[model samples]
Target: MEAAVSCLAEHGWAGSTVAVVAERAGVSRGAAQHHFPTREDLFTAAVEYVAEERSTALRDLFHAGPAARPAVVEALVDLYTGTLFRAALQLWVAASNEEQLRPRVTELEARVGRETHRIAVELLGADESEPGVRETVQGLLDMARGLGLANVLTDDTARRARVVAQWSRIIDTTLA
Candidate 1:
């Protein structure tokens, strides 16, 4: 899974072949094939694997007490702007034009999106039943995704930090 994620993050979807993943994993191609019969399976599994890892990390944060709004914002930013999101972006872009991978990617994305929404609500202490709270959570996610994309090709660290700080303030005022 790590190898697959690494491949996707570094090489994008077209370059993340099973053979390449196998080579990176220091495993035989047959072994990789035995576990993942197809590219779609491998990529889907990679997405799930990263999601599980992130979920575990978020679980810890969720139990760490009522996090400050800024802390929660920072955590969400870190989560979305990291390697996992980058690899997922690669898969999303590739799946856009690849008929064979679209269904699996779509399903995986939906599952992840739902789980992410749940986590964001929990982390932000936002009541989804409240008007605007759901949109707030989604807007934060969309902002983080956009920042992640910007970070892909440029040094957006300063800008990201500023945006996160400003957004955190807005969230505190809006959700308070």
Candidate 2:
């Protein structure tokens, strides 16, 4: 699964063939085929694998202590704008053009989105029933996604930091 994620992250969807993943994993093609008979199957499993890993990390963070909202926001930003999001973006683009992969990708995306929202709400200690709290969470996720997209074209470190700082302030004011 790590091999598959690495392939998608580095090569994009079209280039991340099962054979390449097998080679990168140091496993025989037959072995990879035995586990995933189709490209869609392989990529979907990879998506789930990464999501599970991330969700676990988020849960651990939640258990650690009461983190400051800005720290939580920065952590969430790092999570969204990192390798997993890049790999998922590759799959999303490919799935748009590939009919066979669309259903699985779409389903996985929905599940991941829900889990991400839940994690954000918990991390922020924000009451979803409160006015604007849910929207604020959604906004944060959208902002992170947009930043990740911008990161694909160039180094967006300075811009991303500025945006995150501003957004963190907004979140504080909204939740206060």
Candidate 3:
């Protein structure tokens, strides 16, 4: 699964075959096929693996007391800026063109998005009962995703820091 995520993220959909992933995994192609049965299954499971990692990251942030607004903002942004987001982006693009893969990818993305939003809300101590809080959290996630998209082609680090810092302030004021 790690190999699949890495392969898909680095090499993209056409380049990442089950055989390639199996070789990277140090296993036989037969073994991978036995487990995954199809390319969709393999990639779907790979994305699901990444989603679990994201949930774990958010949980760790909560436990480690990154509940401080800046820390939470940075951590949430970090989630999209990393390899997992790249892998998922590749899947999303493939799913866009592939009729067979669209529904599964769409459903998985919805689940991951919802779970991430839930965790982000908790870590940020967001009061969803109040007006606009839910939208605010969703906007933060959407903004993070845009940052991740901006990161794909170039070194968005310096600029991303500025954006993150500004967004942190926005969240602080808006949520305060």
Best candidate, TM-score: 3
Q: State the lDDT at 114 in candidate 3.
A: 87
lDDT of 1 by residue, 1-176 (tens): 98899899999997889999999999999999999999889988998899889977986976968889899888887877778988999999998998988898999999988888888889889988889989999999888888889998877899899999999999989998
The superposed Cα distance between candidate 2 and the true structure at residue 95, in angstroms, equals 1.1
Candidate 1 backbone overlaps, count: 0
Q: lDDT: which candidate is best?
A: 3
Better of 2 and 3 by lDDT: 3
- Global fold similarity of model 3 (TM-score): 0.97
lDDT of 2: 0.88
Runs with alpha carbons beyond 4 Å of true place in candidate 3: none
Whole-model lDDT per candidate? 0.88, 0.88, 0.92
Query: Taking the tens digit of each residue's C-alpha lDDT, what string does model 3 give over 81-141?
Result: 8888999999999999999999999999999988999888888999999999999999999
State the lDDT of candidate 2 residue by residue for 49-97, as single tens digits: 9988988888797697888888888888887677788899999999899
TM-score, each model?
A: 0.96, 0.96, 0.97
Candidate 1 segments exceeding 4 Å error: none
